[model samples]
Target: MDIKSPLPFETSDKAHANLFNRMVNTLVENDNVLSQQIEGITNETLFILKGDQAIQDGSVSGEEYPIGITFMDIGQANDTGYPTRYGFVKNEKISNFRFVQYYYGTGNEAGNYFDSTGIWCRHWWTGSGWTDWHKLSGFLHTNIGTTGKQLLTKAEYQKVLFNRKIKDSHNNFDIKNNRFICPENGMYSVNAGVYIESFQRYANFELSIYLNGIRYKNIAHHRQRPESPSDTGILNTGLYGAANVPANKGDYLEIYIYANYEGDVSRYVSDKSGWFNYFDIMEIGGRNFPRV
Candidate 1:
């Protein structure tokens, strides 16, 4: 991964202009293996060659710029110059012969700053032309605080709030809202578990996973209590639930619990403690196929 950094360019310099144009053309023509960089004034408009424009792959002006991978950042490039705003192009031809684009500035429902948001897409080059772009989803894992969360009312379901994030690969998890917004169209693996503090008899608990405010699956529904009132040594158990949920982009998921006892519930907060209270989601598979 050789980096060509601080490669200065002047707008009025004809030699620099010609070199920049050639570099752009080189990026357009190359498939994968090399990357070139150009540092210049921000927000400069650059053209990308598409559909067999016959540009030389490693020829930049009179010099030969070898190509394996290409990377350039011309901040906020005009929409007229490229299909994706503020996105740089990278070509990678592995065994699949696919071109991949990893980009940010994707506005999300979780109110993530556009530049902080990111996603990846890829398409195949089928000899004739490129295929449609396929967007990939992100993964998320979050959990509650160490002190545990309390259910205020018995027999009434309430949204469980997770205040900590163990993993948020795509910035899709909203900790403040206790929801995971789907970043792309796909099926997700949803899993969550909670341990309620039990100090009474015949206490019941039910946990459900919700998709876009609708109950999608019940992960836990059971009763737990002490075996005997005189039994002083007893610890109740936690409930774990998982489901395969389908969601479109911008769709969100949440977890809710209904308990017959109104009290605090312990959650898995520390790996060393071996407690198991947490929520997790990951994109399994799905694609928006382009019509022939």
Candidate 2:
């Protein structure tokens, strides 16, 4: 039989000759029957239109499948995306589709068991196309104490309470050269009488008064006093003095004494000296009040 080869008969046409040569080269290179079968299968199965259709039609509407929706295993390896669990739904894009894991529990109660002790569980978000995993919740719990009795926040306790002595001074009424001024509008009775000025009450305090740089007396509210002088001379006489004046809303009284040498003391002796003498007067103390 005189067989004819499938070569280009028109040698004058270069394009047709080139096409024929390419066809012959491809056939010679893949001469196996398996290669021919594979080529046929690829041509029948591979369809770009199907791929485009799948991409356009495949969409995950979160309303239909809420969080924690489990997905069954599809036959294809690529289709098996993620395990179904309860958690946040993220990255609802076409390139990535997945299900994240989540859980909730209380912290270590009395017995290290997860109970209702105001502690929360840990959670995470993961998927196929996502590069990194994320933490949606932590294991630590917060203390929600009772209202009004709870600890004060930084913004609530940012203040200072101030208590200051606005004015403090002492008047010496008996100093020979030194004169004394009355803090109140009261009669200055110079005799064996009491002179009292109100002051703030102090608890557990040390009070001291000086006469010409000499330590006159030191006394507290709860201490006993020494015996009075019998001389009646009144000079350097130890007098029973007190500074304890009770005050509810913080008030105080101060007191001093002077002898009227011109009065009834004239019946005593030769020097009827009822004139005022030099006496340096002052008072100082502190009160340990309760803290608010």
Candidate 3:
């Protein structure tokens, strides 16, 4: 560490005992290279580890090692403070994974558990053992605000209450039951939309995509007519769609709206600057469950 103590050994110059035996062998080779890099970081790379030091170093229930590189301060070990995590567990033949990666060290974010700072969670020893922290990044985008029209009916389908929440990283958007609740199992990537105010002539309009409540996906279907029998004028339309849905963990998603012109149709609140009626979900891909 910037070592330099050899200058004091000049007994009276005659190469001063061979420069004081090469400055005591360069201080015993820099003390054996700083004790083998501090014993490979305190015994094989555990540099600053501690969440009880993974069961005090035995490597969590020990089935055969594999638990180093941990760093936790969870507010000084569960004083219930929060922030500071960095883990990595592993363990095979019985599964056990871990992962973790946290931050948000200070400035007291004030919470009720939804500030994952740099978020990346994981956990997996299943059969009832360790399976809670599962946020591997899922997202949501919502929109809804209708103070006027909304009367659909080809005899059913009507659950598009998006309710407003733009960008939910892992809260899974459940604005009081206007659902989206899927937080694991993956493959999501849905995008939906709606905004039609009146189009009744041959009128068709349909936009669906609901999973836990069944109607799986009809994305959008619009059919308007007017340029024929002396048009009556009242036609505005918008329908959007995107899919890829596969979801699982508590699966729940919804967005419905039917039509065949059963009266009034959509546009309850537009002009609040924009966004007709939306719902975007995201989780791109992840699997390993009963999704075939």
Best by TM-score: 1
Instruction: Please provide, for model 3 over 1-292, each residue's C-alpha lDDT reduced to its tens digit, 9 standing for 90 to 100.
Output: 4445454555666787787788798887888789778766653355444545433231233333344444433443332312123223333333344433232333333462333332334343434443333334323333433344455546466786666676665466777877888755556878887776664356777887889998887877887666552224566678888777787778888888776653443433133323666777766554524546
Task: Name the regions of candidate 1 deviating beyond 4 angstroms.
Answer: 1-133, 136-147, 225-235, 261-274, 286-292
Model 2: residues >4 Å from true position, as ranges? 1-9, 13-21, 24-132, 135-146, 151-292
- Report the number of the highest-lDDT candidate: 1
Query: What is the Cα-based TM-score of model 1?
Result: 0.51
TM-score of each: 0.51, 0.14, 0.32
Put down candidate 2 lDDT per residue, 196-221, tens digits, no spaces.
12112211212233222333334322
RMSD in order of candidates: 15.5, 32.1, 15.4
lDDT at 115, model 3? 33
For model 1, residues 1-292, the per-residue Cα lDDT tens digits are 3533444455888988889977866664452233333333223323343334312221112111113344444245344222235444444434234444333333443653332344555444445344333444333333433235454366678787665677676567887888988766667888888766555456677889999998989998877655564223334557788998877778899988876742444322123221476787766664544338
Candidate 3 Cα deviation (angstroms), residue 77: 14
